[model samples]
Target: MERAEMKMKVLSTVTVERTDDFYKVVDQLNRTLKDKGLTFGFALDEKDSNKITMTIYEV
Candidate 1:
């Protein structure tokens, strides 16, 4: 029998009124993902806005 492969993807967004808040949010997210045995990918921008986005993919 052949083993099946699975993929998981997660997206998170944070909007902050201050620059420090942005870094803090990202740091928390990284820790969360590390605890979950997940890896971080790249973020995508939708149009042009002040929102920060992140993407994660794992198998």
Candidate 2:
């Protein structure tokens, strides 16, 4: 048996202020919507300490 490969596409990228509460929203969305083909992720920008790079993807 073979497993099907799922491809992810980046739908949006935005720079936003890094805050604890904001991450809570992203985490909630991922927990609730990931199986529905959408996911949210974030990482601190290498050049900025006060901002985060948020990416929305289609799974």
Candidate 3:
């Protein structure tokens, strides 16, 4: 489905220290969501240096 067509349902917001590459984090999140049969609504990253606060939602 198109991104704009997605319907978001807030799930969880979390903060984590950067332990891996940004792209790797994204890929892992995609894989995890797919495994759970969940659509990835979107993610908001409040990035500050090495710390990232990520808000994850379901579609």
Best-fitting candidate, scored by TM-score: 2
TM-score of each predicted structure versus truth: 0.39, 0.79, 0.53
Q: Which ranges of candidate 3 are over 4 A from the true structure?
A: 20-22, 35-47
Model 2 pairs whose backbones collide:
none
List the candidate 2 regions with Cα displacement exceeding 4 Å.
1-4
* Consecutive 10-residue window with the lowest summed lDDT within model 3: 37-46
Better of 1 and 2 by lDDT: 2
Write one digit per residue (lDDT tens) for candidate 2, span 1-59.
23267777999999988887888889998999978989899999889989999999997
All models, RMSD in angstroms: 5.7, 2.6, 3.6
Report the lDDT tens digits of candidate 1 across residue range 1-59: 33265556554433333343665655675678776756554333465455445555453
Which is the leading candidate under lDDT? 2
lDDT of each: 0.52, 0.88, 0.62
lDDT of 1 at 33: 77
lDDT of candidate 3 over 1-59, digit per residue (tens)? 99899777767767667555655666677787866645433233455656666656666
Top-down lDDT ranking = 2, 3, 1
